[model samples]
Target: MEETILVLDKIKKSFDGVSVLNGIDLEAKRGEFITLLGSSGCGKTTTLRIIAGLESPDSGRVLLSGADVTDTEPNHRNVNTVFQNYALFPHMNVETNIAYSLKLKKKKAPEIKKTVAEALALVQLEGYGKRMPSELSGGQRQRVAIARAVVNEPEVLLLDEPLGALDLKLRRQMQLELKRLQQTLGITFIYITHDQEEALNMSDRIAVMRGGVFEQLGSPAEIYELPRTAYVASFVGSANILTGRCAGGGDTVAVDFPGGTGSALRRDWQGREGDSVTLAVRSENVQLLSSDDSRGIPAAVTETRFAGGMLRISSKLEDGTEVVISRYGIGTDLVSGDAIRIDWAAENAVIVLPDSEVAHE
Candidate 1:
């Protein structure tokens, strides 16, 4: 069984009379890569601060290694944070920066030098230790920041959008690097990010936050495939959300929505007759067929675009609801104003409750 390294129990916080965190709870396992994903002002950063002892919660407790540390000071906690700005001193070289913490603890020069060298090698910057922050590239500087944070070997590493400052290509590269680094070092990582792809790519599990609360928390596949709420479905990935009423079925629940009625596998909350619900279907799950196909819903093609390895089609249903479809490979012959029918298997459709109706755990 995995060991629990950190726990946030019903953490609540407010600032200036405005609530930011609403009784959130999370338990992180040792060496786990968990991401707090949400848009701006969603309390993800505030939660990180609370974990690092940089911010105090109005209620609840923070437990690390099964010990309560709710009132611990930031410096006293066995945790380190790496910010987006790569907060490195321009005057200090990489070796000096990594050795700073060790030196402050009054470690011998030989041990500091050996530890610093090991850290540099771990981040793939073995010989670059002599280089100053200004002399290195953006990616290198960020790696140096990571090296400095890891030199002390904190139990938990809190990364606050460490790749936000890098360009698109570089950011993509760093995402894999960070994940590999976490696995290699076996450190518990609590990452914060607003980017869905980044969270999906790097996280072992994700906590999707919204309006100061966690909308959903699950593995990447679970968050994308079986979101518990409509907000989670739309936020964590691309989903075509449609309002519907439950028609009630045995193995599958029939949802009556615009254009047509669709069947979804029943699980958890079985819907009552005529109860309102939401249907979330991924773009790739939507299949476009000939207009003559009677089994599909009629829709008018609005636009089609080639997205490198995939083809994206935008269509509008008779009720004016827009539906997007994505397929891999070359472009399709369908164009604007063309008539098409869209359909999907019952298994591909996910039934979710409205955000207001979703019960928090």
Candidate 2:
């Protein structure tokens, strides 16, 4: 059985009468890398901070390994945070910075030295003990920050956009490194980030937040493939949305999209024909068929761009709604203004709702 390491029961937090976290309930299992993925002001970082004890909740409870820690001080909680800025002491070298936490515990020189050295080795900075933060690259500095946090071996770890400062390639590299470190350490990592790609790449589970509540929570595959909400569908990745409501008796329904009427099969959706709904399909899943293989729907190719790995073509329906289709591999025969059929498999299309939308109970 997987043990629940952290639990938030109806957690609420407000500032000056405006609520930021509106009754958030979530759980993190032991040794899981759970990411809070959302845009700014969506309460992701606030929730992470609440778990860290940096801010006391206005209501609700926080449990750490089944112990109530809502009133505990930041230092007393079994969680450590790595800030976006790395938060290293500008005046100290790598060794002393990591040793600072141990020294606060009053450990002797031999013990602190061993712990710091081992921590450095864990982050692959074994020989950088004498180097200052300024002497190291951005990635290395971030590693030292991780080493500092991991040296304590807390029950949980928190990272707040720690790689936001790095470049694209470095960010990708760090995401892999972070995933590896989490597995090797077996610590529950509660990461918070607004980057969808990074969240999908590094997390065992992802909680999509919107308007101070979790829109949906599941494994990366589940959230990506089986989004429970329209906000999540739009937020997680590129989803071409079509709005309509259920048409009776069976799962097959005729959806009214901006483009045209289309056949879509939805799974267990609780909606009536008059009830508004949205359909979501990924661009990559959309197949661009040749004119000979065309559907009855009229569409015109408006633009095309080569994305190195794939050909991205922008199309417009007769009704003038934009549809983007990404075709894999080499195919340069398409020209602007050419007519084509942009169709996706009925099963590949997803139905979603906006933030204000409700789900079936």
Candidate 3:
């Protein structure tokens, strides 16, 4: 069995009577990479701060390896945080900055030197120790901050959107690097980010927050394929949610949508006859075909966008419901006003409900 390294139990917090985290519960195993994903002001950062002991919850407990650390001071807790702003000492060189934490602990010169050298190499900045923060690029500075945080060998690392400052290309590269470092160091990472792609790419599990609580918690694949609510289906990825009514119940259930009717493989649905429901499908899961194919819902391509490897096609049905479809490669060139049809497999259809119904379930 995997060891549970961290646990947050019914954590509740409020600022001036305004609740930030309302009864948040989460657990993480050793060396697991967990991401707290949500939009701005959704309490993801507040949750991270609470875990790091930088902010205390108004109620509930924070446990590290079965011991309550809710009342522990920030420095006393077995956790460290890497902020988004790469908090580094402007006056100190890389070596000095990395060694500052160890030296403050009153370690001997030799021990500090050895540990700092290892930390530098861990982040692949072995020879850049003498460079000042201002002299380094944005990515390099971020690495230095990571080295400083990890040098002390904290059991859990809390990252608050640490890659937010870097450019798109550098941010993607650093995401991989951070995942590698977490694996290599065997430290549990509690990362906070609003970027859905980052969470999907790096985390073993994701806790999607909304309105001060976790809307859904699961593996990236599970969350994307089986979203519990319309919010989750729309937030985590590009999903086209269609209002529908349940037709019948079986291994494959029938759903009637405004544009068309379809069948979905039952996963987490409990709808009865005549009950209004919602069906969600990812844009990538939707298949676009020529109108003459004589299958699927008829739609007219309203927009064609070239997005790198995939072409995004926006189409509208006779009911005027717009749906987006992603086509890979350049097999068929499409333009606005082109006639097309879209369809998906039964298994690809996921039943997502309103937020309130999903929350109770």
Candidate 4:
């Protein structure tokens, strides 16, 4: 087995008696791009700060390249962060900013220049070395920040929403650039972002955080398909959840929902006959037909929204249960007041726990 480049063992943190992180255990392999994905105030930034030595964890250990660095100062640890605000020295030029850390290390002038040059080239900012921070674009400033961190050649790179400041197009471009950089450099990257698309696009593995704990961790496809928790399913993407009771089948379970509609079992949840369960289906997995009684019970159309090449048809069950269906090839006939049916395969559904997150009460 490959040794983990970074590990957080039994980490905890709290502020003003409100817990932000509750015993988080995570590991990062060498050169792996791991994104800490969650909404605002989910303790993602706090976790990054603790790992960087900027904040103290109540009780935990921070390891780097198999060395215990929990007590090491931010500068002493082999890690650096690129914050969202681009914390660049206002008075320094690009070259000076990149070489600032090397100067602090007391490296020779020639060595510092060479390292700075190499870092700038790595970030595709070779010719902009003499430009001031104020004169560069938001993306350029971010690249400079990245260059400064890479100039040190740290074992880990901590990015706290570094590309959040850029507009949509540039952010997408930078996402690609960052992925390429990680592949070329082979340094462990701990990126934090609230954008689901970015996390799904860039991460080798994602730690979905909510209520101060990791909800799920896996590859993008695995996390999307096999979300072990309800919060993870709803947070990562759009899901149409329906509540029902479990009924026994020969080898598989059957869920009989309200309005006499039954859906094939989505999971092997431990439940007795008549026990309540929530059945989840992704919008994309749902099948929509033009007429009522196509598959199961009739659904009353409530709203319709166009999403580029696809149409989102919203409907309510006979018991007023809301369900969303995503289908392709939009048509003018997709409007409210149309009665339809919702069809989905058994493999497309999942049974999830009602509890939000383990960290929550």
Superposed Cα deviation of residue 328, candidate 4 (Å): 1.0
Query: Is candidate 2 or 4 superior in lDDT?
Result: 4
| lDDT agreement with native, every candidate | 0.89, 0.84, 0.88, 0.85
Give the per-residue lDDT of model 4 (tens digit) for 97-180: 999999999999999988998998899887999999999999999999999988888899999999999999999999999999
lDDT of 3 at 112: 95
Worst 10 residues of 2 by lDDT: 352-361
Q: What is the per-residue lDDT of model 1 for residues 5-108, given as tens digits with 9 covering 90 to 100?
A: 99999999999989999988999999999999999999999999999999999999999999899999988888988876878988899999889889878999
What TM-score would each prediction reach against the true structure? Answer: 0.93, 0.90, 0.91, 0.94
Model 2 lDDT tens row, 300-329: 888889896888888887766677888887
Candidate 4 weakest lDDT stretch, 10 residues: 258-267
The C-alpha local distance difference test score for the whole of candidate 2 amounts to 0.84
Can you give the lDDT of residue 192 in candidate 1?
95
Candidate 1 versus truth, CA RMSD in Å, comes to 2.1
Q: After best superposition, candidate 3 residue 353: deviation in angstroms? A: 2.4
Judged by lDDT relative to the true structure, which candidate is superior, 1 or 3? Answer: 1
Ranking by TM-score: 4, 1, 3, 2
Where model 4 places Cα greater than 4 Å from the true spot, the runs are 264-268, 289-294, 332-334, 356-359
Model 2 residue 238 distance off true place after TM-score fit, in angstroms: 0.7
Q: How accurate is candidate 4 locally (lDDT)?
A: 0.85
Candidates in order: C-alpha RMSD to true structure: 2.1, 2.8, 2.5, 1.9
Measured by lDDT, the strongest candidate is 1
